[model samples]
Target: MHMLKKIGFYIVAKFVPLLVIMLTTYFFSRWLTPSQYGQYSLVISIASGLSIIAFQWINVTLGRLIPKSSADVKIKIINSGLILYFISSILVLFLCFIFGEFIEDNFKTSSYLIALLAVALGGFELSQRIFNSEERVLAFGIFQGIRGVVFFSFALCFYYTEYIYPGVVYALIASYILLSTPNIYKLLFLRKKDFIPNSIKEIAVFGFPLILTYVLLYVLNSSSKILLTVMLDETYTGYFSLGSDTVQMIIISVMGVVQLAIYPIVIGAYNKNDEDRYNIFSKSNQWVLLILLPVTAGFIGISKGLFYFLLPEEAYLRVIPIVPFLIIANLFVQLKSLIFDYAFHISKKNGKQFLPVFCGAFTSVALNVMLIDGYGLEGSAFSYCIGCFVYMTMSYLIGRKIFKYPSIDVGFLFKVTVSSLLMLLIVIQIPNDSIFQFVISIVVGALSYIALITTMFYPQLKKYINSNN
Candidate 1:
């Protein structure tokens, strides 16, 4: 399928579900205190990290190989991946059981929560990877949409239950299980009896390094909130988490569709004609900047509007000031993870990918320890930004040594930057007196950016449209 159509399908796929999540967050803020939400966020973050550990390798290993593999190899990959999934799930749960009570007290949830979440989130995530790897864009989108609706419905229901935090989680787990039901037999019964067990060894060698890499990545993402919770209080953690989560949502919604669509296509390009891989990578990077820069700039442009009933709760209003920093920081983080570090996957020596992320993670943690006591929340945000810059820079620098570096079109980047800045200038100048006006400004800014960028590509677009007709 054409890349544009794939991305368009994913836009609906990601957008609606994320929209539901964003709205759900607003309600969560209204429904629970910052401290309560902080506790909830902490548990969720830990479970998310566990989910990454338990399932990421399977998804990523398959994702990297599936596009180019023969049908027999694809079956081996899936079946062997399931074996790894079972082993990892059991291992994580066993460890969680051992540390159960301590975790519950420390993170403010049942320790079993991680076990459930690791299974639930990890299970569906593996399925999504399969859908994306197979280029089943519509299936992927529908799966996510269903999860979003189920999450919304159950979350609302769970809020009134006695154990609100755990109930919220149960709602999400239920959704994953609901969608995952049909895949159960397919995952188990469809396994080839003649599968080579060495495929398991092959996967371990390919993906083992990623385990620690994810620990560092998790530090870059959530350790700050954890540190805040320890250094100050859960309220502070909640404030920081809300901003970070919103930024994460935006980055994923914008760039994730591109990455998902591009991953397999680029992999196919690498296998068929290695020389074309650079072109594919380069073009996709350009598109990422085109969409991400303007959207991020616009989001930061009127970020203060977030406090104007977007959060609804007065306590969360405190987060507005730091939200922009988090937005910029996370933007760099995603650009690094989704774009630059893709070299490692293609390099097939993903082992070497660890150092840059380690350096960045160390930087963020050290800075947080040094600054958070004095500068407080803002310091954590600044540390995060600087750390992300280091990660992206180092990844680009080192990643080039591993594989052919995708040549960045500096000229195109400049044009996109200029267009984004102009759009930001126009949007920032708009009076944000009312929520209505604030929303209009966002619409206006988006349209302005689109118009400016589209104008730059007008001749090519016109030629393509004319040729198509």
Candidate 2:
């Protein structure tokens, strides 16, 4: 497939479902009370956090190893991964069972049930990663889209029936079960192989460090919710979660598409010691910033208007102050993932990757604890922005020292930043008193950004367009 077409499919595939899920939550928040929505968010955060600890390393390992492996070795690696997943799943379940009461008290639910669902969801996610590593972009996109559609459809039904939170849980479990089926078949029936102990050990050694890294990163991202739930109440958590989740959906969708599409190419180029690797890495960052910068700015500029359209007035008002901070925080998070983190991966200095995230996570936790008591939800948002800034700064410094990819074009970056800022100024000046104005403002901002980008890089853009054509 042509690289551009592949990237387009990947982006559309990921973006559509993410958009659906975000919209679903937006509607769900309206139907459910703040406390109820907060509980739902808490459930998801806990499940996602646990899943990261249990399954992230496996996911990372597959992405790192599968592209370089022979067909037979790929099968072996998959088998090894399956074995590890089963073992880890069982262990996690046992631990959940052992601490069921503590878990129940903390999340105010059945810990065992949430644990079981998380394991199932983690399995589905791991399968998706496998497909991604194999470069089965269509399959990856299709199954992910299916999960989003099924879950949203079910959740909608539950919302109308007045069983919002429990219904969401059931919908997710069912959707993930359906989504996991194909990957299960691929692993167990068509390409089944005996477990390879040596392969398992190799994957373990390569992946364990990533587990800690991801856990700290998750803490950095999620500690605000946890602190809010602790310091104030679930209602406060709900407000913060709503803002953070909204921004996160946008960030993850864009970053996921870019990372999934480019990671293998980057790795392959580096492995072969191709000089083109530098150009590929540099251009990827440039393109990423070009898209992400304006999107982030636009989100910040229109957040008040957009949230009012999507959420109840009270709920929307509660989050207005923090939305820009969350958007900025998420932007930093995306930058770290795409550029700094990948540098460590390419250099095989995975261990060094953990330190910066650790520092950030520590800062996040400390600041949330201290600030939430005084500043409320806004404090949490500010802490998150600070933590992420620290993480990005540290990662860039460490990554440059360990292994440097090509530097991004400062002149191009300046142009993109200036253009995006101009769009933000234009967007913020638009009256957000109604939905029509809100929509028009977004359209105008986007078109203006595109116009500026074209003017700034017309020759390169024209050449690329002609080549693709």
TM-score of each: 0.92, 0.91
Check candidate 2 and list the clashing pairs.
none
Per-residue CA lDDT of candidate 2, range 341-429, in tens?
77888888898978899999999999999999899999999999999999999999999997766877888999999999999998899
Regions of candidate 2 where Cα sits further than 4 Å from its true position:
1-3, 101-109, 160-163, 187-196, 432-436, 459-469
Top candidate, metric lDDT: 2
Cα displacement (angstroms), candidate 1, residue 263, comes to 2.1
At residue 326, what lDDT does model 2 achieve? 94
Clashes of each: 0, 0
lDDT of each: 0.78, 0.83
